[model samples]
Target: MTIHSVPGDFHIPFDDLKVVARGLVRPECVLALDDGSLVTAHGQGGYSIISSVGEVSHHLAHCDTARKYVPNGIALAPNGKMLFADLGNQYGGIFSLDRHGHLETVLDSVDGTSLPPSNFVMVDEHDVLWFTVSTRNVPRSKSWNHHVRDGFIGVIDGDGARIVADGLGYTNEIAFSPDRRWVYVNETYAQRISRYPLTGSAAKPRLGKRETLVQLSEADLPDGLAFDVAGGLWVTCIASNKVLLVRPDRTVQVIVEDSDPAHVGRIAAGIRESSLEHADMQTPGNSRLGNVSSIAFGGRDMRTAYLGCLLDDCVRSFRSPIPGVALPHRSRRIR
Candidate 1:
């Protein structure tokens, strides 16, 4: 499968970007729909719905009074429910939120082991659910080192939920290839993007051997994964505030970036020395993008790029030269 590269001269100008939605807290994951609306992961609890006209409304969960709702990655189910990964302080799990704000537990424990701070979740076209756990470390921040490899990917379908792949180096996000033949994921601590071929029966699915697609540098701790219609993979880096494009040919391009060299250097050093502290990732040097963490394509043409961030209160938007691969939820309504 030969994939060509995007135009070398194409890049997103920071000055031309616009704010799509505001007053969001830790909007770490954004899912754009065909009608120009967006659903992003809310830091405080549950998720927020941004209407096409820029109206914002929150549907927070009141499931647990003791545990704070720290949603990381989110997905829009075909039935209009929102599936969010609970990154709670002491525990982690995947939960679903209905239109009425009713919450239901999807998976809190798998294979007799309780999930540890779930990171990302996705519902594919077939209604099959997939998720990732960045690491098994108690604090999770302890696995910020490149050497930690307890991360894994799990799937839920007709056969029930089970881990299909393990030994990942801090998996952050996962995306299926355009044809749904391959599953791609970003290993944040390992600084690489890897993919596995889809094999076996649909009911009893399996993933083939992992293939390294992109080995990134410490400065680019990949956090998000999205595929453009042209076969390019767009990755968002947390500390450096960079959006990179990995072409089908495996060549890399910096589509946009805003960073403080000194701050990025400190983060890189901590990762290299396996001493990264949670405090180190608390604040980003640049406030413009709030350490952009995720990217999504929306709008009528699917050429509008929406950025999710760790520290920002809004999702940023920009025009892209290439249209993005339409996600399974693009045509689904929030109801």
Candidate 2:
């Protein structure tokens, strides 16, 4: 898979992308470390590392005995702890997965009631952790309903866990603006990206009114989000198997769309099983299918953006037109 950097009117074709690994079990959210290794949450209840070239390395932390801990989104803290969201029902919430595969609860409940299954997480530069819960309604499949709006965005800092925002349509990834003045979140079921003003201090901030930044087509289900240095948002749309670029001025452009029908079918099946079964699952790593779950920028100059998948066995890569804005711990790994 080779994606070329060329000019196009509607969208830039993603060419020259190489599959980094094969045989991953529903790898969802991926984060690139300083040492060139990628950490991603697996649907099989743990986390795995991918080499710079895409080899599936050893498990960073696995929980075969605790299969209910469906690792969803992940972020590595400066203290060497991997904070990840558990989408399982029995033990759903945010947890810190240690190198030894031990799990420690971070934010399971607020005011006593248990938190719903977590979706995505982001750790800011100030060590503040922000996470989202898709919804409390379960058999786990209820989250697929677009009308479900019980989802919420929460914050965990030195203080504690607090609900910063609520009433969302299946929230997925969360990102901050380059200027740190705005917080963006992807409403997957709603097929839109909404931005909220970042008020108060960085460590203890507040989310202001919700503003729709971009409303995607109904056929598109927006998922992961990343920001390029040019202040453009790179969004991965699931089901539709496409990536989108939303500019600061709210103009949306299709960056790339996977044309493989077989891959698309597999992705759609994988998602269906997830909603109905709510159990552990895996996928055959082949075909560069778009069920893209997350995006991150890495490489020597930070121009390489990696696309993590759900049904695809391997992660995909492509070069970006501009460098991506560095995350809080971009390329930094735990020693």
Query: Which one is best on lDDT?
Result: 1
lDDT of 1 by residue, 181-278 (tens): 89899999899999999997765678999999999885788999899987889999999888999988888899988877888899999999998888
Give stretches of model 2 more than 4 Å off.
Answer: 1-15, 60-67, 89-91, 259-290
Lowest lDDT block of 10, candidate 2:
276-285
What root-mean-square deviation over C-alphas does model 2 reach? 4.8
Instruction: Write one digit per residue (lDDT tens) for candidate 2, span 41-126.
Output: 77766677887666775454554564567778988887777788888765578888777777677787975788877888778888
Cα lDDT for residue 16, candidate 1: 75
TM-scores of all predicted structures = 0.97, 0.86
